[model samples]
Target: MTKKAYSKLLATATTTAIVASAFAPAASADSKDFSDVSTRYADAVSFLADKGAEGFPDGTFGTHLSIKRVDAAVLIAKVLELDTENAPASGFKDVPARAVGAVNALKEAEIAYGKNSSTFDPDSHVTRGEIALWIERAFQLEGSVEVPFEDVNNRYKDAISMMVANDITQGLTETEFGVSALAKRGDFAIFLHKAYQAMVEQSDFLLTVMHTNDTHGNIQDIAKRATAIEHVRSENPEALLLDAGDVFSGTLYFNEFLGQADLEFMNYLGYDAMTFGNHEFDLGASADGHKALADFIKGAEFPFVSANVDFTKDSTFDGLQNFEVSEDPADGEIYNGIVKEVDGEKVGIFGLTTEETPFISSTGEVQFQDYIERATEMVDKFENQGINKIIALTHLGYDDSLQYDNDLELAKQVDGIDVIVGGHSHTTLDEPVLNEDGEEPTVLVQTGEYGKALGTLDVTFDENGVLTGYAGELIKVSDLEADPVVADMLKPYTEQIEAIKTQSIGKEAAVVLDGVRENVRTKETNLGNLITDGMLAKAKTINPDTVIALQNGGGIRESIDKGDITMGEILTVMPFGNSLGIMELTGAEIIEALEHSVSAAPTASGAFLQVSGLNFTYDSSKPAGERVQTVKVQDGSDLVDIDENASYFVATNTFTAKGGDNYDVFKKAYEDGRLSEPGYVDFEMFAEYLKGLEKIEPTVENRIVDLNAAE
Candidate 1:
């Protein structure tokens, strides 16, 4: 604005600030819900209102309204506390008088740059990443913020992270920061207030780290996540975004597109850095070894930082390098970690993935090292280079507890690390836990799997470079509005998924198959019975003696709501492509396996077995290995038991047959040649069996009972 207009605006803001300041302390921190905007952005809008930023003349915060570059520049000028007395300099060809000074101030300050030396897109819409660049530059951010945002354009990745590390912005979901989306005016006000506070606080600075883990190809809700992230970044450019890997598997999105849809969305979100999760290696031992991972890496627009995996031996990682500030992400994806500047503070970043990946997914020829050892080594490297603030982007499960892996274990074992963004174990650490149990205070945080939740961790370090204080929260992405642009981007891919998903497996369920992960894992449900029965049917086809079948709770990811069950819904519930195996187990081994199933009773475990052609009663209050109070086999409506030495045939999935979920007996049976492969794809078998019975109802008819009385 011109000098005169600037003075008038300042006077009005000062008066409003004074009036609002009186009640600001009394205003509860909870966001005031706005009907027009997505509930997810309520906090950003409410924060601005609390900070004395007036709404539109109509007395509403236009959250979904597009923000203009000129108006955005005014907010930036106000928050940076830039000088307004300078006369308007109308140098741009399309420059207007009111915005000339604001634009000039930002350009001179080197915070906002011109589209060219002669032009600034002052009237254009402000994008999430573009705003981050201006704000990061405005504050002279010298440290970095890194994330697994789907769309970290090479041009603005650094700026995006710079904003994150300074607590200037956040994300919609843990893995998305909405780089391609436009900002709103109400959010612009919130951004300025946060910047103003950060600018005013000189002795210490705050950085908000937004993180996510294990999305596993659930990109359908990414657009909604984009809206929430853009709203946050629009307000706080100095926020750090991160992902703990596993963005590569589970649904049709990955199976059909081969990570293309996921990669595009990540680029649109503008992540700074990401680590490798086990599922990233889910392409398995391929004929062309590292080709799948290579393709994923080659398409990445952000740095792929992983300190543990040795990709050097593989030609797929030929372009991998430890990135430097001078490198461009578009040239090729960088690997490992490096130092970055955020708000003039030097911060070092390192990446690590779980050593257990080979056991769970297919890493092929890739090798993994001890997380503690690699983390310590990386920390020493960063410290030796003089970067005190260290963040470890890791795929170690939140509390994996393996001596060689897990974020909690790393926190206690490593010394120099400040924060760990973690995944695996599908843990939901809604709050950042301070592991003062170690020599150095390490704060560890993780989000639950899927794009279901977003985590924000606010950390502050003193001038001495010691992490002093912190706060955090996990945001649910369900409340946000899906961005139109992101929705458009997913249209074609989504159409492909729906086409398959909607096809009738030519069957319907008379009773609801309760496939809820929590319930299925803890006890026997009708759906589990039906699934196991299907396996038994398939096993019978191979050998009539194969009478029993078992399905592990873990392999079942979702539940088919009561209705005509489509192949799509079945796949959604059982997304993993697991095959069936028919194996022999003695009566004694059967009892032992039943004991193992309930070993983690009281607390749900995916290893819990859902059985068919048999019934048993278990007391959850009993100790592990002793939970089965009774067991019996069904033989034409008759129950039989008492033959401990008799060998019986049973069917199960390849994951459990080969010892996944720690099925030691089954793995040992496989090793002994007692486990025979029937070669049945579990989901297809279920679909085939469903086709046999046009309308079937699975009944929970005391097949297996949970004896714990609800007192």
Candidate 2:
């Protein structure tokens, strides 16, 4: 039989078996009556009946009935005892206005999230994998296990793994876990029973970890995550809400509010602890961004922790604590961790961040230490303080790169760290990754970026407060309802920022590209051409000698798509508040900069230069300084050989003028008074120039040529 047909047949047979078993003794004299009752639950009647769950009184269990999204939520809430007192106010638009209470209850308990906006599709069908995730969240298992399904990757793996580890419907069979299969009511009932039993077993220290990452200024998802965490809190008093960071910066809302709205929303959500992400410093290397961070800390109900950063030098943040050690009566002092009394047992928490923060972060004043070294030190400190259970809240990315190591390495290197709540790389761990470096297992997990998933690690410790085992799952935000208060708090900022972003700046006749992989620095995109072209246009008006303009590839942050482009979009593309400046250089100095550009071809190097009104060529096979052997000027007639004796006015941004991109040639230009004062031209003026053009198109016209072939 086909798989579909086989599944249907199995479902029917299972229901029949359950119904027959329920009435076998009493219906011995009435076999026909027993057969009549067997049609509803099919394979699931026994399990549902055993758990005191009854179907509609029509003598039918409705095993084949497709489970509505709302029903699935209600089932989880009912089974986990998620109710009104624990759930926050509902903000979802589609959730039945009256059913808001039930939805809020489930949200507060950390059982359901709306995904985006305050709109839950209550009528949607519930998938088998989804139900498993809910069950895992409700039960709170610990330890990282591989996901059973082959199709599940970093995205939904965390949820699937959690469900599998908790004994929730084992992915269709013992070996094959299909993440997309529809959940039959009978199967769902069985999973719920198993989860309920597990919860009952752990009635002592009911620990709930409600976590969200890569929030990116998405206030609506924050509300949903908060509601779900609250739902977990209702079941257990010792619940804690944690964020893996990158909460502020990214979207228009973040740029507009400058992290204020995010702070307010996070405050409303009641986050317990959070770490820093690279994007947190997008504003610039200034005290204003730090002030914003300080403001957030002041408003936060929980602590902001980062072990690698030495904030002692920054006097503005003197009040912020570097590390927190909480002691449990049974576990003693827990360093780099938080100890909470959950069901009377002590739970510990710690925090870490990526070592590449120094390179990626725009906050130049901030510094980062070695992640593994700092983590080891913190672990030693905490262990010395007598803390047995430890969890690391890490912002390190999931995959290891040459610049920085992933969290798996950290878990292996650190002996005492038990669990790691990870972010930065946006990896979704369905099951915890096993630490290859140590004997003890280190649970590593990350909810996907943009608050799309919630990660819950349900851990159980022995009587001595030493961690014994754990289970974890990632809950998708798409299935639950959003909380209203958080949404309301963000409404004004969202509307304002969106309006600003949508305001049209110009029209495009064709697609304007930006960066290309492998040659992002050397490549000439339509957007790059437009930006350099604008700089040239703006500079020639000031200095008639301006024969060419050069813009660093790194300075061109975004591409302008072919459509109604806007001033706001331009601002987003070039959010760094840099201004245009003019510099004078000889042909030899220009060649030096061009040589630097090709030195790092096929890899990202800040020194890659995009030029306007000049054509040059370089050979990657040649040495750095000798690569650019030919330089010519585009004089509207043909390529004329550059005049080494004559001075050329080069227009560039303030960043490039400061010898950025290894263009030390500009340093001589600056010292010679050739570097003019900052001009009126900025990204905004460029956008207006595009708007005036009505329709501008950019093409690669061999601006750079290789002289090696000519020779």
| CA shift of 396, model 2, Å | 1.6
Question: What is the lDDT, from 0 to 100, of the residue 401 in candidate 1?
Answer: 34
Please write out the lDDT profile of model 1 over residues 1-711, one tens digit for every residue: 123333333333222332222111233233453345456566565655543334443444566677878767765665544564473453666656556766778777777767786788778899877777777777665557566777787788887776677677776567788877887665665565565555545435556677778787789889988886787677568677778888876666876787888889888888777788877776656676657677877777777777778876666777675533222334236555766567778777788887766654567667888777778888877777777899998887665434336677788888989998888656667677778778888888888777788788767777878876667778788888889999999899999988977877667777678998898998878889889988888778666888788999998888877778888888877877576666789988888888899889868899999999888888888888878888898777788872679889888886787688988988788666565542345666788788898578888877778788432
Tell me the spans in candidate 1 whose CA falls farther than 4 Å from its real position.
Answer: 1-199, 321-331, 502-566, 572-609, 612-628, 632-711
Tens-digit lDDT string for candidate 2 (269-338): 6667787776665454664647776666666666666777656566656756545565431111112456
Q: Which candidate number would show the highest TM-score if scored against the true structure? A: 1
C-alpha lDDT values of all predictions: 0.72, 0.63
Using all chains and alpha carbons, the TM-scores for the candidates as numbered come to 0.55, 0.50
RMSD of 2: 18.6
Q: CA shift at 100, candidate 1, in angstroms?
A: 49
Off by over 4 Å in 2: 1-48, 52-206, 234-237, 287-289, 322-337, 464-468, 502-525, 528-699, 702-711
